[model samples]
Target: MDFSLQQIWEHTGLFARFIIFTLGFMSMSSLIVIAERMVVFRKTRSDSRNFASKMGAILAKGDLSTAANTNLGKDVGHLGRVINSGLTAYRISPNDKDVAVESVARALERQAQREVQSMKRGLGVLATVGSTAPFVGLLGTTMGIVNAFQEMAKSGAGGLATISAGIAEALITTAFGLLVAIPAVMAYNFLQGWVDARSVDISESSNEFLDVVARNLTGGETRSQQQAG
Candidate 1:
């Protein structure tokens, strides 16, 4: 058996060819998704950090309007959007502390859900490829073993040379499948971790923003009561 690339391709059976083609497609798709996600996460992380710094300064100065308008005409990330949502809600019901707090809380929750969905996009495909690629490879290996036995039976000889070619060709698909699967699995885990960490940041920021809104609202209500008294 020559066992070269040309020889393997030429000797590959129809089933083996189909399996290899499928694995190749999966690998390519996963790579594309990984690249796209990397870019998206990077941009969001950068934007969020910038938004956080500006937002901290604005909040420290008690400028709710500026915080609300910070991302109005500009591109912002998940944290910015969430903060804007809460501020917008507060603006809409400025006088009623209870209404403002409730509105901001609801807005934060809704924005969090949307951000999570955006972060989780394409993760399903990676998970599917990681979990199933190995089984697909195993199927190819089994098909190759059957092919080896068939060749032996037809030749009426159990010699190594008689069945080795079929066995080798069959094993090629399995090897290729594993090659596709390992990276997909590792990438899936890495991206999942990134998403989780970002989710935590969004949560913490939302909580802090809510506390600020609550305190301001409570103080305003107390001052109004004191003036009335």
Candidate 2:
């Protein structure tokens, strides 16, 4: 290669490709987050609707098996899983309804935390790409500029044409990098917010379900017993 501006562009293109790769991965991460959120939404909605109805019925009839299986069958989402965990725990110690409800709530809370962690998977990578991709592109741009300046020094040409190619390469690389980074950054932020909100919803719903279970199990029995004693 004569090491001209065109040569520099060719090399810059390769660097641009690297930026592209980073952006592509970032896009995939965003998509994954979106998919997870969608799944969570659907499952949470289904769980909330069905859980209350089924649980109420099960509790009314004192059918622990159906209630327990309802929890198992719910694909409502992470929150459902948490609710199910609590319900199952309660089922295991049906005699101590108060203690069982409390134990299930704790277990469900822990499971909810884990599910929240799972929902956050790959988010860090997206954030890293969004925050650092531009810098990576700038690195390539800087390299291209250096090469251009070197050519200028060697050519001893004092015209815009002499450096135009190099300048183009530099600008192109930088622009491409920004293009890659901006969307990745945006998606990362959007998805992060969505994930946090989803987790909150899960926690709230799980807690509410725990309350329902507690109320059903105790049913003023504890209060009446304490008053009697």
Q: Write the per-residue lDDT of candidate 1 for residues 1-229, one digit (tens) a residue.
A: 6989799889989998999989999999899999999999999888888888878998987667677666634557888888888888888875877878898999999999899899999999999998888889889889988989998998899888898888898888888889999999999999999999989998999899999888887887898999999
lDDT of each: 0.87, 0.70
Which regions in candidate 1 have their CA more than 4 angstroms from the true location?
Answer: none
Error (Å) of candidate 1 at residue 94 is 5.7
RMSD of each: 1.4, 4.6
Model 1, TM vs. native:
0.95
How would you encode candidate 2's per-residue C-alpha lDDT over 1-229 as one tens digit per residue?
A: 3456467556565655565566556556656765776576566656656655656566566555577766346355565566677767876765677677768878888888888787777778767767876887787678777878889999998677787776777766677667777876776687678778868877786767677777766765777789999
Reference-based TM-score of each model: 0.95, 0.75
Which one is best on lDDT?
Answer: 1
- Over 4 Å off, model 2: 1-65, 71-74, 220-229
Q: Which ten residues in a row have the lowest lDDT in candidate 1?
A: 67-76
